[model samples]
Target: MSDPTRFIPVPTPETAHFWEGARAGELRLQRCADCRKAYFPPRAFCPECGSREVRVERASGRARLYSYVINHLPAPGFTAPYAIAVVELEEGPRMMSNILDCPQTPEALVLDMPLEVTFERLSDEISLPQFRPAKGRAA
Candidate 1:
């Protein structure tokens, strides 16, 4: 038998809105009311000064490549040979995501590469955020 397909999530109530926005093709982050810092992963409080007051805002969906790892092994229900990357968003938060829409190769994955968010619909209600080269790249 198999372990079955596992859906990964935070299981928290406060971050629901952020996930919803992702499903709708929009990047969402929290803005600290006290310090005015935007952060990702949808937290309940600010990481800067521990302020509970915050608000959700739309992100520009643009980021620069920070780091990445090319996975040769399959991850659960996923296929082998994928790139898991951390992208530093234009809004000042770094988030973990997958790089897609191109050939996953050593020459293709470069550090500090400019990227833009594009949604891959996993299900009717779930859209996974993936990144590709911003534009004008030879495939």
Candidate 2:
């Protein structure tokens, strides 16, 4: 569980499954049945082929750090000097999340560093997926 001061996300009809998956300790993504492409920020239609033939699939929970910025300013539910990052999922989609459980430093947060998903439960209906450095992997 995160601090109560943290901003909680509300699940909409299109994103309910994603939240549910996080609650169950899974990272879920949508794939287009027509184009076979995976995408994030769950939507009803595929962004590539404009097809509604999409299915939700559990992701490998593996990713690599693509980009990030070390935040030095205070924010609700977050301490200063945290990394706000974008991770490229193994499924070929990218998602924004916070980097935790490691030193928040540039030298420590290398681009292309291996990462794995972890969840922080904010509520009964919301468990936010975050990432951390992969075990047994070097940056």
Candidate 3:
């Protein structure tokens, strides 16, 4: 069942490819052709070089937990004691997402722990890219 009160993102021209890739079970990111720097939150230009020469590429779906906080406050469509995390992707970009399939605790979410991408479908056109403990990694 879907959460009626959960926030849903509307895809725009800049982010259309990202949403599409998520629905297809791929993590899409933007890279600066001029500087070869990978970036997230898809944009028309690269933040590093300020160049319009950017390209979209599929990510490896691998990352490491960089940081996180366990939220105990209540929020609509969310359970209490959930982890809000920032993960560093293998391709050298960092993104913020919720940690799933693991305990939302300081001990469970160690820094630099390996993670893998997973999708949470919110609608036909929207799927959130989240992360979980990688196979064989202690959760």
Instruction: Tell me model 3's lDDT, rounded to 2 decimals.
Output: 0.92
lDDT of the candidates, in the order given: 0.82, 0.93, 0.92
TM-score of 2: 0.96
- List pairs with backbone clashes in candidate 1: none
lDDT-best of 1 and 3? 3
67-119 per-residue lDDT for model 3 (tens digits): 88889999888999898899999999999989888888898889999999999
Say which candidate scores most in lDDT: 2
lDDT of 1 by residue, 1-139 (tens): 2224735554358778877987888888999999999987788999888999999999988898899888998678667788889999998999988888767787888888889998766665566677888877634
Residue runs of model 3 more than 4 Å from their true location after superposition = none
Off by over 4 Å in 2: none
> Which residue pairs of candidate 2 clash?
none
Clashes of 1: 0
> Model 1 RMSD to the real structure?
3.1
Q: State TM-scores per candidate.
A: 0.87, 0.96, 0.96
Better of 2 and 3 by lDDT: 2
Local distance difference test, candidate 1: 0.82
